[model samples]
Target: MDKKDRSILALLQTDAKLSISDIAERVNLSTTACWKRIQCLNEGGYLRQQVWLLNSKMLGLGVTVFMSIKTSHHDLQWLRKFALGVRDLPEVLEFYRMSGDTDYLLKIVAPDIAGFDRVYKKLIQIAELFDVSSSFAMEEIKYTTALPLDYTHTA
Candidate 1:
């Protein structure tokens, strides 16, 4: 990507609601040119999707937790089943297949302890897991909905 493309992406990452004209003004480009660049970025798959950052607390999702999962059998078939089970679970906001002691890590949000309990119970019934440890996030000190934009210079 060009330097202008990088700058355009940086601006949008902070606020997707910015008008094309406003973005063009800030990035030293004409409105149409800026709009074309954004469209290219999207069509080229550089920009996947835009999302609204929501506050879990304000939505009554008062509890957030990280679940570290491990399985007795690390076979691929079992993993597929596990993934499918978690795929549509509304409480799980994010899932990561990690490189560590755990096979997967899940970021979950629930209304309260009881709400979380319901999710917890349902998940255990998916498979006979070796370990499923939870670590509640007491406070999210810094949560950024944006990715760091130093990728322009990457080889």
Candidate 2:
């Protein structure tokens, strides 16, 4: 990727609805060239699926919980089953296997504590867990879906 490609990505990250013509104009590239570059980026896996971010608060899902999970089962069979169970839960927006004290981390959003309790109940039913801890987010100081392009290889 070159400077222009990086610029294109930056603009798209800001607003995915921007037209090819608008992107072309901003990046100082012709429409056709801009389209080609975008296609290349998509083909090369630099561009993942495009999605519209929804307002959780407006949608009645204002509560955000960061759940830390620790389990004794480290085998693949247990992991596969646990992963599949977590994937089935729509309330879990993000899940990760981590190092250090925490075995797994889950970012969950719900309507309230009662709603979160429902998810927690289902989660514990998935498998035998050593520990499960949760922390509620009081305020979102900074949150963004956009990633920095400074680390991208320049041509």
lDDT of 1: 0.88
Query: How would you encode candidate 2's per-residue C-alpha lDDT over 26-133 as one tens digit per residue?
Result: 999999999999999999999998999999999999999999999999999999999999999999999999999999999999999999999999999998899999
lDDT for position 7 in model 2: 100
Relative to the true structure, candidate 1 reaches a TM of: 0.94
How accurate locally is residue 25 in candidate 2, as Cα lDDT from 0 to 100? 100
**Candidate 1 per-residue lDDT over residues 7-58, each given as its tens digit:** 8999999998999999999999999999999999899888878887887889
Note the Cα lDDT for every prediction shown. 0.88, 0.97
Score residue 30 of candidate 1 by CA lDDT: 100
Task: For candidate 2, give the lDDT.
Answer: 0.97
Lowest-lDDT window of 10 residues in candidate 1? 146-155
